[model samples]
Target: MLVQGETTFEDCLVSLNVLCDVLLTVAKLMYPLPEFVLIHKDESVLKDIESLENFRLNVYKVTLSQDCELYDVELHTEPNYPTLGKKFGVKSIAEKIRQMTDTDIEKLLSKGESESPLIIIDDVPIESEGVHFFFRVVKQTQFEAIAKQGCVVLLDYTADAALKDEGRIQEITSRIQKLRKEAFFYVNY
Candidate 1:
């Protein structure tokens, strides 16, 4: 799973492509055995894949349930006219996402099964103090209540320059490497 964030659509596409390449390389190196790799997303990034070569992975474009779709009001504006309408307030966006999440939870419960090992690639920064509160509420109210569920929430912070600087990237990469090594050690133990 890869999440990408940027002020411009092109930047987001570049970040996503880079992340995809990294993931593909890691998978190839770690697992020599043949395995299926799938890419799932909305149709937004379809054209961007034409530039990526050497990875023979199947891509699936599925429209998420209306409730599951996290709408970004920022993306709705025309390039020349960017204004937050009264209806497009931050509170409104949060409410919309929450409503959609609730609907998804209901649908999952009705099916009598859960989507285990579910990965959510959110282009939004989950570490923001304001957003963290909302995420905790969502997890406690809806996600955690679901049974037999495992979630990997990958947050992309490329939108913020401070978070994507060389030093920060190196720090994040080191932490991720440490986590992977620890997991491997535990598995081998």
Candidate 2:
């Protein structure tokens, strides 16, 4: 997002707003929608996914790989926690996490969780292989009617560029599928 090295916070805010608008535009083009809202610093959206109306379509929660950076670990101690609650922010840090390279993360997965002991409570050490920001999905169980209508709900936390790139990929995939069906391919085998 800071590609051009903007010199002011105002520039950053404006950039973020522009990014959100672009993302919404891309999402709308790719997905069917009755409504879409761009929320800034809003947590109310996470309360209940089932209550959300999904344009008479099935909603699915898609989870991708964990993305973490050096600043990502700083949420453990900050103004963010005192106001937003501990659970609202990333709460733990592993040794070398701030300095760990992508190669390090990949090597960690290959080895095991035994290396990084994250926390200790009541004198017992709690081990963590790695830290990740988890995005959990709340299903719409109460609305049987909406479920039958095919409402797919998705929440993504990727960068704006990544989102746009993925949307384009989805568009290509959809076109390929459409062409495949149009060619009269048999389902057998």
Candidate 3:
């Protein structure tokens, strides 16, 4: 029998085996992995998706060429929580942060000494004067253009690209796996 809070040697082995299986499945795809993948979902959409207590979405980036198809999937639990500077339409907070004096920075770090928007840095609480403007998360509607870039694949949640592609890739992966299992020409060799 297994205890509620305790883990046994066999339990650890099972966890490791599952991890290995996932890795092996990824390797079987045989595609050149990209350096990174980017996800661009609106804040409202993200919130709605998270409303389901146990539902976690799997977003995948698929690249296809004449002879190769690659699927890259990442599971992200943390939502994007930018500083209040973004929410307030402050063009560049980096410059303001850099210009702050050591004392001002210290105020943000002091326990309960500073208010929000000033003390929050990237969703983390800091100890600041005038820094309460930094704690709030940026609303996507107010600052979407700033996040766009060139050459990178952005899975935009507002459009069909992200949704359409994810379904297609899953279908392809399933078909490939089915074919591999059914192929029997090499059974004698």
Candidate 1 local distance difference test against the native: 0.33
**Candidate 2 TM-score over all chains jointly:** 0.22
- Once superposed on the true structure, which residue ranges of model 1 sit more than 4 Å away at CA? 1-30, 36-40, 50-128, 132-189
Q: How accurate is candidate 2 locally (lDDT)?
A: 0.39
- The total of clashing pairs for model 2 equals 11
On residues 1-189, what C-alpha lDDT tens digit does candidate 3 reach at each position? Answer: 777999999989999999997776654442222222323334554354345425433433332111101222211111122643445444344445545554564454454543554444445443333343222112333112112211123233343555555655775677677777788423344
Candidates 1 and 3 compared by lDDT, better number: 3
- Which candidate has the highest lDDT of all? 3
List candidate 2 segments past 4 Å from native. Answer: 1-159
Better of 1 and 2 by lDDT: 2
**Which tens-of-lDDT digit does each residue in 1-189 have in candidate 1?**
345542677777998999997875443321111221112233444334434433643222222221222422111111111222322345444553344444453443344424432212233321112221112213221122111121112222122343235445555666688888988855444
Error of 3 at 133 (Å): 12
Against the reference, the lDDT scores of all candidates come to 0.33, 0.39, 0.41
Q: How many backbone overlaps does candidate 3 show?
A: 15
Error of 1 at 156 (Å): 22
Lowest summed lDDT over 10 consecutive residues: which window, candidate 1?
Answer: 72-81
In terms of lDDT, the poorest run of 10 residues in model 2 is 142-151
lDDT of 2 by residue, 1-189 (tens): 556655688877998999997776455645322232222122344334335544343223422121223112111211223322333333433333444454554454444556654434334343452244221123432211111111222333333555556557777777678778999875787
